[model samples]
Each structure stands twice: as C-alpha cells, then as structure tokens.
Target: METNNVLKICPPEDSMKDCKTDIKCPIVNCDKVVFSSGSLRMHLTRSHGISESESDDALKRRIKVDPKVYKEYHCPRNDCLYNINSERHFTNMAGLKQHFLKVHAEKKFKCSKCDYGFGMEKDRKRHESHCGMKFTCTSCQCTYVSVEALRTHCNRTQHQIPEMYTK
Candidate 1:
C-alpha cells in the first residue's frame, strides 16, 4: 500500500519566531536584521555598494573570516521579491527549504484520513476538522459518524471488516 507522507512544516508549537526577521546583516559594524536573503543582498548592493555577483561567495567568506557576524542562508530562487529594503530570507537552510516548500514548490495538501486533497493548507485543515460525516461497518451494517467511532465499535464487537474496507 502506498501511504501519503504529508509534510507539516509550518506552525511549530511554542516557536513563533518568523524566519524572515531573524537573519542579521553580515557586514562589519552593521547591526541590521532584514526580511530575506534577497533583501540582504539588496542591502549589500544599495548600502555597501557590493556587487550582487560577488556577494554570495564574499558574504559566506566574510562570516567565516569574521566571528562577530552571523550566518544566513540565501534563497535559491534568484527572482524572489525585494522591495523598499525588505524581502524574503531565512536564517537557516531548513528555513530556506521550508520557504521553498511552502512558496516556490508545487504541492497538494492532503487529508490524513482520506484521499481528499486541496491546493491550500487552510482548506484541508477546515475540511479535516469536521470531515467525519459518516462511516459504515460492512460486517454489522452499523453506521458511525466518524472513522474513530467505527473503529471503536469494530474493536468492541469483534466485527472485523476487510482491510480494504477499513481504510
């Protein structure tokens, strides 16, 4: 059986810090935190007169060469937006991957309980909240309002349905 492995990246409980706001400007004597790598690259270009072409290697080297400055993961999407000294960026590669997975990558949000899918996470969550309309037992011909209820009834009564029907 092919099972769906849904990746839930966002909304980590107890950690509300936005990744876009955590990256610090790596340039010396600069205590600035910006939105994204594109924004930081833009900042380097506009404020420091650094060339965009050389910034990636140069910026990484600067961080290693200088301990005072912090690290940043540049967005892989070069065409990502930058506007008015603010844009998308991440502090870690995981954050970058998460951003890409949520924004740049094409995906379908699926319900863990069923084959239902949605283009947006919000829609899937809303559907899953009350998705339990009804489930029927093949053995006893009993109807249940939810899969959990049906499973409970099956376990208590030992009225086992086929594996295909259970799923």
Candidate 2:
C-alpha cells in the first residue's frame, strides 16, 4: 500500500456551527465563553497572557493547518482588510510592506484633464483616451480629429481658443 504524504487542512465546519452557540477558552480557570474560535484565540492571548505562538499552535492542532507549510509572517495591523478568505499572513515583512504600498499608498500619477489618479504610467495613459480632451474648438463649437487641425482652424478663422485646447 502506498502512503500519501500530503497534509490536508480541512476547516472545522461542524465544530464552527457548535462554536456559534458556545466555545470556551482552553486555558484552565478562564471562564470566558467566546462565540468563535478566533475570539477564543484573542481572549487567550489578551486576557490570559498567552503568547500568539502558543495560541497559534493550539489553533493549528484544532484546525489542522499543514505542519510542513511554514507560515511565519503575519500582518500585525487589525484593520488590514487583505486576505479575508485565507489567513492574513505573508512569508516576509517585505511582501506585506509591498502589499500595503500598492493598496494603501497615494497614487503618484494625476491626470491633468480630470480628478482621476493612477499608480502606474500605463494606467494613466489608458485613462487619457476617455479624459474628454478630444480636439474641440470652443469658438466654432466644432470638433477636430487632431490638435493640428484645430490649431489650423483657429489660425485661419482668427478664433481665439483656450490654452487648454492645444494640449
């Protein structure tokens, strides 16, 4: 008979249903009754002075995350909304920092035509097509296919166009 080496971590859906009613802390003499496993883990760490590693070990034993899968880094910020379905964990601080910069940092590229901003040059370029900056002659109420054509019309008709129209 061949043995399977893969470790499967199945969620405790049945126990979770029971946890909805009652789930007490594992620490002795602690009468805290939490409604979920996460809350119980938090209670263990905050109220009983249990370290996060200890609570994580106990949780792993209960929930069965693969022991071979080494997940060390975790987002310390409670308000971090990334990875809601899976564990909000990373392999290193650099990865977490990159995620924070990409998601939370201010956009660097600002569109001159509108209030739209983008984090990347390509995204800003893509926005320019729909930015409503098509060559339009305000004096004649005519639209041209190109800025050169609009400039020619303005020069020939002596129609004064706004400086923004040349761009």
Candidate 3:
C-alpha cells in the first residue's frame, strides 16, 4: 500500500539551528538553500516543475497562516486607494517593490500624437483607438478604421472630395 507524503516549504521553527532564512526546499534529500521565500518558491517552480498555487498552499501550511510571514510588506502610498480598508499588502519584499515601481514609477509607454502616457502596452493600445492617427472620409459623413481601409474605400468608390486625407 502506498502512503501519501505531505510536502512543506519550510521546516518547523524548532528544526532551525543554522537556517536563519527559513526558506528551504521541501523535496526529500534536496539540500538547496535560498535566502528568501520568493527564491525558494521560484526554485520549486523552475527546478521541480511545481505550480505556484501548489507551493503557495504548502508554504501557507508550513507557516501556519501567520500574517507576519505573509503580509510583511505594505504599500506606503497614502493617496493610492487599493484595498483601503485593510491596505494593500504583499507577501514578499520583491512583490511590494514591483507594485511600487508599476503603480508609482514614471510612465514608460507614450503616445507620439498626444501627450498621453501609460505604464503598459495594453493601456497605450486602448488610448491609441481615440488619440492615434485616424483616417476620415471627406466625401461623406463616414470614418474608416485605418489608413489602408480608407485608401481601399476611396479607390473602390472613387469619391472625389477636397482634402482626401487628414490626420
């Protein structure tokens, strides 16, 4: 008969003599040592092909639902209203750092036609629909989706109107 073996992300506190970091691989006989909990999670996923949810569950079980261990980092922005009742909390330092960089850092993507800027490409694309270069039909009260579409419509219909192309 086969017996189920439970996996844990870290050993109990009583077992820690020299392991100050406390983040150790749960795999049997694996001596891999990492500095942070995040690194250990990454090691589990990359090296052992364990999914994030699996590692997270194991970590939670090992840590015994300790809020101090999980919610160590909190967002410092006072004006930012993310989870305002409880405040935005992160599981690790890296997650908090990344949240700060993404939410408060300078915008990376900018629209050339307008002064609008965004942090992500998808936001820029959404803005482009309204602010980016568009083709309008001068002949009638109609607008084409793109320049190529306008050109095709104009070529096919041969509608002669003043100022055929406009930005």
Q: lDDT of each model, Cα atoms only?
A: 0.59, 0.57, 0.56
Q: What residue pairs clash in candidate 1, if any at all?
A: 36-88, 36-89, 37-89
Q: Quote the positional error of residue 64 for candidate 1 in Å.
A: 12
Model 2 steric clash pairs: none
The per-candidate count of clashes, in order, stands at 3, 0, 0
What TM-score fits each model? 0.26, 0.26, 0.30
Expressed as tens digits, the lDDT of each residue in 9-47 for candidate 2 is 322323312223246687788787764456676667567
lDDT string for model 3 (1-167, tens) is 12133111222223322222435689998889765567788777667767568546665445444333333355555565532234445655555544554576556678767867765455566767767556677787467656667777877889653364533
Supply candidate 1's per-residue lDDT for 145. Answer: 70
- Once fitted onto the true fold, the runs of candidate 3 whose alpha carbons sit more than 4 angstroms away are 1-73, 78-102, 129-167
Colliding pairs, model 3:
none
What residue runs in model 2 are displaced by over 4 Å at the alpha carbon? 1-78, 83-102, 133-167
**Candidate 1 C-alpha lDDT tens digits along 3-96:** 1332212333223223344368999999987656666876776678776575545564554334444444444444655111223445554555
- What does the lDDT read for residue 22 in candidate 1? 35
Best model number under lDDT: 1
Q: Worst lDDT window (10 residues) for model 3?
A: 1-10
In what order do the candidates fall by lDDT, top score first?
Answer: 1, 2, 3
Score residue 131 of candidate 1 by CA lDDT.
85
